[model samples]
Target chain A: MKIVAIDRQGKEHTLEGRDGWTVMEILRDGGLDIAAECGGACACATCHVYVNDGWFEKLPAPSESEIDMLDMALAVEPNSRLSCQIVCSETTDGIKVTVAPE
Target chain B: MTAAAPIETDVAIIGAGPIGLFAVFELGLLDLKCHLVDILDRPGGQCTELYPEKPIYDIPGLPIVTGQELTNRLLEQVKPFNPQFHFNEMATGLEKLADGRWKLSTDAGTTLIVPVVVIAGGAGSFVPKRPPIPGIEVFENAGDGVGVHYAVRKMENFRGKNILIAGGGDSALDWTINLAPLAKSLTLVHHRDGFRAAQHSVNQMRELEAAGKIKFHVASVKALHGEAGKLASVTLAGADKSEWHHETDAFLPFFGLTIKLGPIAEFGIHLNENLIPVDTAKFESQTLGIFAIGDINTYPGKLKLILSGFHEAALMSQAAFHIVRPNEKLRFQYTTSSSSLQKKLGVS
Candidate 1:
């Protein structure tokens, strides 16, 4: 699957991920430096990222804990979701996410 | 050599995790001495305790490695230096001594004198806080068989069982989402309807509830019912003065633990939400001779990764060495031949 991550500098890097890996793992393994403190357990909000507006509906809804973590994130938006909690699937292909500025 | 005041070693490391161990390894390469301390009976800090079995896909060189194996590799890398280790002892307090030595007190009533302390605690010792529900204190020593659980690393523990999850935060939701597929029945109860997690997770839970994959309760656990010494059901009361009882086999409360900064806070260290603030490049704290590393240190552009912590430790060791021996030239000399070799290897 293809996931686009926009960094703080507005540079977008399209990463490839398997169906099972989360967005946080895909971005991190690709050297984008998205901090995921809880290792995708959704225990920490460090992996907060914002999804493109229209694309938000294309993905599964985040759990309540992911929303709680977005509250603690730096640049939270209505589309903010913890990247670790966003698991990739065939339906999530071509998803667009942006790493919020710290 | 001219006789001067007794100069202690360059740096003192306050943890033996990946960051602290990396500091030792780097400083040893620089031919500097380091003293490392940790409360864990062994090294690896949070990695050893929190997710020993989880495979780490990051960390530049290795494709994958378990937390325990990673810790072992780091220990092996630092073994050559013979860095002094103070294990099973927590650093209770820190004070700058008259001779410029850092005096550290342990909970065991022991004291250590060193220079340049590096606070490399990953989430400050990884002490899991138990929920404050009544009767929880009574079940503290009943082991995992009873209704007491300190952590939930895997979802299979609750699979095919009726599970009740508490807390309205990200961990609680993540657990709910993960277990919704495997659990026989799942109920998520929180203190408030508004969740403090990511918006997407909240949306996902609503969708899951709509699809009948799980049930959501806007309340907290008032009472837990047990049968034959194991959890059987949970009673949740809503804010609207409504109550419901659900039979459950496991009750996994994901309310985030209350993290304590402990004695490190007393060292006059600067912090943001209990996280020590450090210079991202140098890993040095506000106070001289006090450096912070790993997850505990927060700063602009601070990426809290094990690999990033390793980088911070390496740089901090060099800075600490300069602080201790300002006049001494370090052993590693960048000769023209070595520079050419580095160039050949595509290293700057």
Candidate 2:
């Protein structure tokens, strides 16, 4: 699977996503500047991302814990989701997301 | 301030994370006493600090364990070792003594001398998150009561000053309530109306705002207008993109904490990308008698995991024992079979 990430500078990078791996892991492994401080544990909201409009509905809804973490994140939008909570698979192929600011 | 007397121990561990906790057990097995220093007030490093309730599945033997649970278990396992812990302190300065010992100092003025120094600092120290505003750096550490501060070192410094507190967390709300009585003017600014802090604190802050003791604004700090390291005013951006300037002599932003390789960088050790380079065998740094493990250390095939740090602690203690007790011959024993090891664990 593949994931497209937009960095803070508005630069787009295509990352190879592994099945069952978190979006945060994929972005970090692909050399994207996602902090992922909790290492995909969904504890820290440093891996926050704004899911693209079309792709927001493609992934599963965030859990209550994920929503709680998002609430702690800065600049939270309706589409704001913790990338660490989003697992990549066939259904999430070609997912697009924009990384949130620090 | 006069420094306190130095504490002498067999090994001085820089962090109280999982790896450092386990190092106590390994070193204790060989009868090497340890003293650990951590920046956080408690143990578990990122585990307890970042995600205590988060479940970790990679720990061996156990299918799953929470971060706090793992820390509690490690604390229990090392209880018999009686490893001294100096919390709420960061290992700031490192120096080699003429007696072939290392002297470690902390921001809290704590000093420790040991033959071996183990750096289990995972991602370094947890420090306050700074607001990502341009030109904010100039306003930091501005002495004589004018600058941006993440923490309140002295309440007198903020007293009678126009202070602006940011974030809706406990620190901001608590400081708002405490400083409002003393400030000439106080403003609490946040991005949203809702707060992530305790309901009691939020209610208290609301009461203060209702009483007109403090100004509450649902806005984010956009820019800091300051000159010569002195903050004069801050530009705040509202939800509707409305911008306005607010006068303030001090800015306190408590957006929670994020870890960084802080004072560890100045320890005179060789660093690669802010991570200490260590050998895969002993996990020792370039400087003899000093070792780095866990996420803070980089080596061939190094993996940043709790389990990996556990293994590294085991090997590191073996090398640390040689340095701490060079005259004594090393004995390899397992906790599963050795009665002496069991005795050290207090099971026998």
> Candidate 1 residues A1-102, lDDT tens each?
899889878998999977999889999898886656667866556677889958888788877656655534433446778888888899888999998654
Candidate 1, residue B37: lDDT: 69
- For all predicted structures, in order, the TM-scores are 0.52, 0.91
Error of 1 at B282 (Å): 2.6
Task: For residues B1-348, write the lDDT of model 2, one tens digit per residue.
Answer: 358899998999999989999999888999999999998999999989998988889899879999899999999999999999999998999999999999999988889999999999998888887766887899999874468998997888887899998887778888998899989999998877877778999999999989999999988888898778889999988878899999999998887887788999999999998899999889999999999989999998988988899999999988988898889999898889999889888888
Lowest summed lDDT across 10 adjacent residues in model 2 chain A is found at: A68-77
**TM-score of chain A taken by itself, candidate 2:** 0.96
Residues B95-145 of candidate 1: C-alpha lDDT, one tens digit per residue = 888987787766755566667778887766534445545565544444332
Q: Residue B13: error of model 1 in Å?
A: 1.5
Interface RMS for model 1: 8.9
